[model samples]
Target: MYRGRLAYRPRSETANKIREVNKMKEGIHPNYYQAKVVCNCGNEFVTGSTKKDIHVEVCSKCHSFYTGQQKAAAARGRIDKFNRKYGIQ
Candidate 1:
């Protein structure tokens, strides 16, 4: 739940049946097709070896706050949830 609302609830089988009237979609992205990824920082490089540009929004050298941004966000969210649950805030 989030802000007094369900974040993820299973959809009913009937809900799945309803389809969009306009069923149009694009193909795979061309950039993703490329085997190599060059970070804007020009400090690091990633290839198919590392499971494709992942776990990072930007390279460490380019981003103002690198390495712990994702971790910090998650920590803050968890702390907020705990506070709400225990009236600690």
Candidate 2:
């Protein structure tokens, strides 16, 4: 990023258009978009609902609730509604 007098003066109309295009690219698809967050200490890694792998550092198996271990980990309100609707135990 150029700053102060070092910034591109854009003397020509073409130069201005080029600068604008560059700005738009920076505005979208930023650098961090490619980096999926891996859980730091073997907890869980999730990219929205798209991906889950267990037992590895970011796996679903190691996550406390995902494997359904800690008692009835699911929230009671949602579970009751689901059971009532689907006749699930």
Best by TM-score: 1
Model 1 gets an lDDT of 0.63
For 1-89, candidate 2 gives per-residue lDDT tens digits of 75656566549998888888876454555343323445646443444333343234545555676767655655777789999999988
TM, every model: 0.29, 0.24
Clashes of each: 0, 2
RMSD of 2: 15.2
- In the order shown, what is each candidate's alpha-carbon RMSD? 19.4, 15.2
Reference-based TM-score, model 2:
0.24
Best by lDDT: 1
Q: Candidate 2 — which pairs collide?
A: 53-59, 54-59
Q: What lDDT does the true structure give each of the candidates?
A: 0.63, 0.58
